[model samples]
Structures are given as C-alpha cells and as structure tokens.
Target: MALQVGLVGLPNVGKSTLFNAVSQAGAEAANFPFCTIDPNVGVVAVPDERLTRLAELAASKKVVPTAIEFVDIAGLVAGASKGEGLGNQFLAHIREVDAICNVVRCFDDDDIVHVSGSVDPARDVEIITTELVLADLATVEKRLDRANRTARTGDKDAIRERDVIEALRDHLGDGRVARTFPGELPPAVARELSLLTAKPVLYAANVAEDDLGQGGEARGNPYVEVVRKLAEEEGAEVVVISAQVESELAELAGDERQEYLDDLGLDRSGLERLIDRAYQLLGLLTYFTAGPQEARAWTVPSGSTAPRAAREIHTDFERGFIKAEVIAYDDYDRLGSEAAARDAGRLRIEGKEYVVADGDVIHFRFNV
Candidate 1:
C-alpha cells in the first residue's frame, strides 16, 4: 500500500472539490467556510499500465495495484494555532498522514468567496504554512518542558531529547519550519514529534479551466506562476489542475473522459498527476509480481534491499529470507514471457544484500 497524504488549504481553495473528484467519496463541499468539518478519507488505487500488460502476458486471474489513502481535512485559517476556528480541530487530522498536498486557489471566482477576500496564492500559502509552523512550535515547546524535567534526573536519553527539542523550539519560534531545521533527526524522535511542517509538501495549484490549458507548461496563469515559484523555493513539486474541471471529469467514463480531456488539451487527468507526485514526494517506487493466478504491484522505498522489500509483502518473508528470482520489466517485455526470460538468462537470482530496483518483476524464495 502507498502512504497517506493529506489535502490541506485555506477555505474555498478547491481542496474538497479535488478530493471529491479524485476519490468520488462525496466529501461535503459548499461555498462557505467550515463546510467540511470532519476529515474525509478515500482510498485510491495507484494506476500503472505495467500491471495491465503483465496481467495479459501472464494470463493472471486477477490484478491488484497498490493504493493510497487521501485525507481531506478542514480548511485552515490565519490564527488556527491559537484555536481561533475549526482549523485546530482538523490540524490533528494532518498529523496522522505521512505527507501533505497543499491546494492553493489560483483562480478568481466572483461567486465563490475567498476567505481572505481575494485570490492570492502567495498569501494563502503563507497563511497555511505559518499556521503549521506555529502549531509545531507549540508542540515542541510543550515537549521540551517535559524533556527538561526528565533531564533534571540526569538520564542520558532525556538530556539528549531536551537538547533536540530546544533547537526545534528555537527554529519554530523564528517562524522556520521543521523541514528546514538544520540537521537530521533521529527516526524515533521524528516519529514521536510528527511535526506537520516537517512533512513533505506537494503544491496543487487550482487554476481556472482556461488557465489549465494555457500551454503545455501552464505557466501563463499568473496565479499558478506564484505557486510555482514558491514550490521551487521549498524544493517541492507543483501540479497545475482545475478542481472544477476535475469534478466534471469524475462524472465521465471511458471514451467520454478521454474525449473531455482531449478537449481540454490535456493528455491526462489531474488526479493522475496527483498520484504520481504523491509517490515521488514520498520517495516510493513500485515493483511487480506476476503468475497465472495473479498479477500484483507492490510499493517500496526507492533504495530498499531485497529482504527489506520482501518485508512489505510479509514479515515472515523477511524473517525466513533466502533469495529472489528477479526479471527486469523491460527484459520481460522483450522476452515475451517469464519462461522465455528465464531460458534467455534474463532472469537473475538476487540475494539478501541485493538492492531492489524500480520495475523489477520479483518472486521471493523464502521459508518460514
């Protein structure tokens, strides 16, 4: 399975529209503030043409692709850290996710009211980022106090924790995000804190229909450009999409959806971009396992070792480790079948130390 990614933005930024369109979960979205009070989660399958092709080649009875859980949280406000609005209630929802997808309103709509009175992508991003930073600041400060109290007992671990929390508090107090904090954090500490700002961010610039197809790059949209520049500064990715267009696309099917996308001068739906970007943001890759029974896709971190990747399938697979019979996807495609690939020596045996690569067709050899 893919990791969870949260969709967040200020009110009226088309966040729920995108979520509803992508997940088809009918997240309640209206033209007012706080319409979506509860977090709406939708599990979406990650699409891969390789899985379809492999199924055909192997004559598999079924196909299963990895999935991601998308959480649509309530809109944030300027003073959310201080419990000014519903933002505080929903910020906790974000802490449950692995990464963030920040939706920015890049379109101007006279009918849809902007929470800030006008559409300003830069300001909207700042408002949301600042709130997250402030909230994390409060969290670190509270943790630091406890750490300091424990440090008084002269516990080595407690003393080290107090030092790290102190630095984090100083960074957040200066309006700096945890992601940009100076050094690497211990994995345990990172898991314990779960700072919102520390999560990787992918920007979704919600543009108008006309702006969506402005050009191949879609840089003609001034509002989208603002978001693009901001994402660049943060070393993030920007996906240009019109939430209204996506909502309309969700109602379409088969040829109809393709025709509509062609009419929009787009080759794919924004949801595809969202899924693709989310994987990249999380540093994930996919590998496949195929047979006459089933063809399935699996998600793993980019540099995962063969045994580590096996753990994703089952802990027992890792515990009783041996070797993995692997075929490169391209080799399998050229050889036309797994048997042919093995006969042609395109299949290789990988050991525990073998690092798994993306697009590998793997069959693990293990014992309990």
Candidate 2:
C-alpha cells in the first residue's frame, strides 16, 4: 500500500475540494469551518503511463496501478494543542498519516471567508506549524521525565535515550518542527517518541485559476512567492494548484477533462502534478509486473532491494526468494516487445540484493 498523506489547513482553504478532486471521494466542501469534522480517507491511483505500455506489450488483460491514500482533515486553529476548534481530534487524525499537505489559501474570493480574517500564507503556515511543534513539545516533555528517572538508575540505554529526548525537547522548545531536530536520534529512541512534527510536510498553495500557471519555476503569483520562501526555510516542497478549478474538472470524464485542461493552457491536470510531487517528496518509486493475465505497478522506497520489493507483492515471495527476471521500461519501450528485448539481451537476472530501479519490469522467480 502507498503511504498516506494528510490534507490540513485552516477551514475552507480548499482541502476538501482538493481531496474530492484527487480521490473523487465526494468529501463535503462546505464553506464553514469544521465542516469536515470527521476525517475523509480516499485512495487514488498513482498516475503512471508505464503501466499502460507494459500491459499493451504483454497482451495483459488487466492493468493495476499503484495507489496512494489521502486523508482530508478538518481545519486547525490557534491553540489547537490546547483543545481549541476541534484541534485535539484533528491532531489525532494527523498522527496516523505518513506525511502532511498544508493547504494555504492564496486566492481572494469575497464570498469565501478566511479563517484569520485575511489571506496571509506565511502567517497561516506559521500558525499550523507552531501548533504542531507545541503539541510535540508536550509529548516529548512527558517522555523526558520518565527517561531521566530511568537514567538516574544508572541504565546505559536509558541514559542514551534520555539524552536524545532532551535534544528533541530543546529543538521543540525553540518552536521548531521535529523534522528540523538537529541531533541524530537512535532508531529505538526515535520510534519511542513518534513526534507529530517529525513527519515531512509540503505546502499546497490554492491559487485562483488565473494564477494557476504561475508557480514552481515560473513565479507569478505573489502568494506563491510567500509560500515558497517559507518552504525554503523549512526545507519543504511547494505545490501550487487551483483546487476550485481541479474540483470542477474532476466531474468531467477523460476527454472532457483533457479538453478543459488544454483550454487552460495546461498540458496536464494540476492534480497529476500534485500527486507526482507528493510521491517524490515521500521518496517513492514504481516498478511493474507484466504477464498475459495482468500488468501491475507497485510502489517501493527508492533504494529497495529485489527481495524487499517482492515482499510488497507477497510475504511468500520474499520468504521463498530467488532471482528476479528484470527489464528496464526504456528497453521494453524501445524494443517494442518483451520478446524483442530478450533477443537484444536486455532482460537481466537480478539477485536478492539487486536494488530495484524506477520503471523496472520484474518477473519474480520464487519457489513458494
């Protein structure tokens, strides 16, 4: 399963709208705050053209794409850690996610209200981040006291763990996210804390349709500039999109949507861009399995070895491991067929330790 990313922002910043567009989950996109009191979870296919090409070449009857989960969380307000504006519940929902998508309102619509009475992307981001830091600080503080007590008993492991907690405490005390915690924490100690701020985050700037193309390398939207500057400081990524426009496009079918996107001077949908960016942010890669019956895309960490990638398909595959017959997607595409690629000696026999590359086609040779 693909890792989940939580969508969070002040209410009415298009979190639900974006969620509905990407996942087609039909999350309620009301204008009022806390409209999404309960978290809405949706799974979306990770857009990959390679899977389609593989299916065609293999004469596969079915194609299955890898998927990612998105959770639409209610808006957060100041004093969230202190139980304001359903903050505790929202924060609890956030704890289960692997990463965060902080939606910042960049468009101005008189009909829609901003949570802070004005649109300030930087201030909004600061508010949400500060809340996360404060929440983590509280959690770390509770852990620190017990760790110190255990260290006082002359336990070496406890002493090391306590020192790690102390370093994290210092970082949180300075109102910084756990991802920026400078010291290297031991694996056990890090898992023991599980601080919320430790999760990677990306800023989603919801712009007007007119400003849709003014982000990333081409800077046109002033609000996107503010978000970009803040993201640079935090070492995070920024995905600029018009959620309202994408939501509208989501209602249309393939050709209709493509036509609309073309009319907007776009080659692809913003949802695709956002999904691709999130996939990269999480350090994810895709590999494929092709056969006469099915062609499927699988997601794995960037440097995953052959056995590990096989385990994603089935534990039996990993337990009864053997060599993997692999071919690069490029070779298959250029050769026009798997038979041609094999004749060209492009198909390779990869052992257990062979690291799977993105767009690799693998046929697992397992005894199980």
Candidate 3:
C-alpha cells in the first residue's frame, strides 16, 4: 500500500486547494466549514529525476516512479474530540494516515472567512493541536480502565502496557503530544495506542502568492515565521505555499505549467516541495529496479531489510529469499552502465540481512 499523508487544518485553510494542486484531483474546495465531508484520496508519483536517467541508460521501455497517497480530510475545529463539526469522522480519517500535513492559514484575505474570525497562525495551530491531544487523551483514558483490569491479573505484558498508557495520559493532560513523551515507547504499546499526536507532522503554511518568496526562506514573512517557530518547538517541518497559485498552476500542463512557474521566478511549485516533505515525514526511501523491460522505483522504510524490500516487490521474492545484486544510483550513473559498474566493482552482492539504502539499484535473485 502507498504510504499516505493526511491534510488537516481548521475550515477554509486551503487544505483542499493544496490537495488539488498536489494530486491534480478535483476535490471540493468550498469556502465554508465541512465542505469536504468525505476524504478525497489521490496517488501522486514521487518526482525523481534519477529514475528517468536510469531508464534511459537501461533502455527500459517504461519508467515508473513510486507513489505517495494524499488524503484530503475535512477541516478540524475546536471541541472536535467531543463530536463538534463532524469531528468524529474527521479524526478517524486522520488515524488512517501514516503522517499529517497540518495546513495553517498564514495569508490575510478579507474575502475569505476564517473559522475563528481572525488569521492567527499560532492560535490556529494551538486550537487544532489541543483538540488532537484531547482526542488522544480520551482514547488513553478509555483504554486505561481495561488495561488496569488486565494488569491487576498479574500479566507482565499487561502491566507494562498499563504503565505506558498512564504515562501517555499524563503527557496528553499536560498539553503535550505523544511524539514528545520523553522516552521511546515499546513497540507493542505504541502499536496498541496509535495515538494521533504520535504521528509525524509537516506544517503547510498557506500564504498569498505575493508572499511565496518570503514563505520558505530562513527569514520568512512574519506570519510564516510564527509557524516556523511553532514547528521548531515541536521538531516538525514547514513548507510554505500559495494554494491559490497552486490551484492556478494545476490547471495548466506541459510547457504552459513550466512557463507559469518560470514567470513566477520559481524553479518548481511549492506543492512539489510539500509532497517531498510529506514523503520524508514518513521516513520513506526509494530503491530502483531497472532493466530492458522497465525501470521502476519502490518505496520502503528508511532502514528496511533486503528481504522486507523484496516483499514490497512480491511476497514470493521474499518467501524464497536469496542474495540481491545492488548498485548505488550514482555509481551506475557515473559508470554509464550496470556492466561497467560491475567491472568497476561498484556492485554489491547483499544477503537478506542487508539494510536497503535510498537510491539503490537492486536486482533481486530469488528462487521460488
């Protein structure tokens, strides 16, 4: 399954607009709250120039890029945890995603209405985060009763899980996210809890087109700076984009799109940057398989084992695991061919224990 990043923010913060730009999917971008009742899902190919070059070198007929799934969830509001503003449904969508893209309003447009009646990035972030925290708190508290019961029966695993739940409840009570719960949580407990706040987040600061240049730079516009500071405190990443501009760009194709971006003095659109950041937020890596048939990119976790990566290609490959003939992308590109890379001793024969690296050109050798 493609890893997904869920778009979340208060109503009318351009989440749908940004989603439309990134995926080119026509999600409803209305100006009112609860406009997007159902989550809009779109799969976008991850842009990697290396895959194109590799396909050319291998004379492959097709080049397929790995994809990321973007889910446009409805806007979140205050008291969402308590079933306000379709909060229950929205929160469920968030729980289904691998990461969160929190779209915050940084532009001032009197024409569009703000749910809170003002454009305050920091305040808006607080409102959304507090609700997520509260929702998680409710989840933890509910589990605590059952966990406490099991722990009382003297099950060692149950005791450990109950203790972790207690710590999580305390962390949420203090207005802190599960991501900042001080120490590493056990895998069992972490999987069981699946707290919304524990998921990685990237902040998309929705700015006006005039403020685009100022949005991403180190010293950005004051509104972006406010969001930057908040992200800094939480160890999250921020990408600034003009949803209106992206919406416009999404309508054009080919050279026209390039011309539009060029006219704006941008090498690439902010939506592209946001997509890359969203991919990174999940700590995902891409490896390649190139041949005369096809050159394709496959997604895996950063430190996935060779066998695990083979499973991404096919369960049979992993079932009958053997060695992998791996070549680093740069080595293959520099050497000009896999044959030359082999002669130069740039190819490696790795076993199942080998941890796959990003940009690796792999040829799995398996027997089923």
Candidate 3 clashing pairs? none
User: Root-mean-square deviation of each candidate, in angstroms?
Assistant: 1.4, 1.4, 1.8
For residues 48-143, write the lDDT of model 3, one tens digit per residue.
889999999999999899888899999989999999998989998899899999999988899899999999999999999999999999988998
For candidate 3, give the lDDT: 0.89
RMSD of 1: 1.4
- Backbone clash tally (model 2): 0
Tell me the number of clashing residue pairs for each predicted model: 0, 0, 0
Worst 10 residues of 3 by lDDT: 212-221
Estimate the TM-score of every prediction: 0.96, 0.97, 0.95
Could you arrange the candidates by lDDT from highest to lowest? 1, 3, 2
Model 1 per-residue lDDT tens digits across residues 150-200: 999999988887887898899899988898998666688788889999999
lDDT of 3 at 81: 92
In candidate 3, clashing pairs total: 0
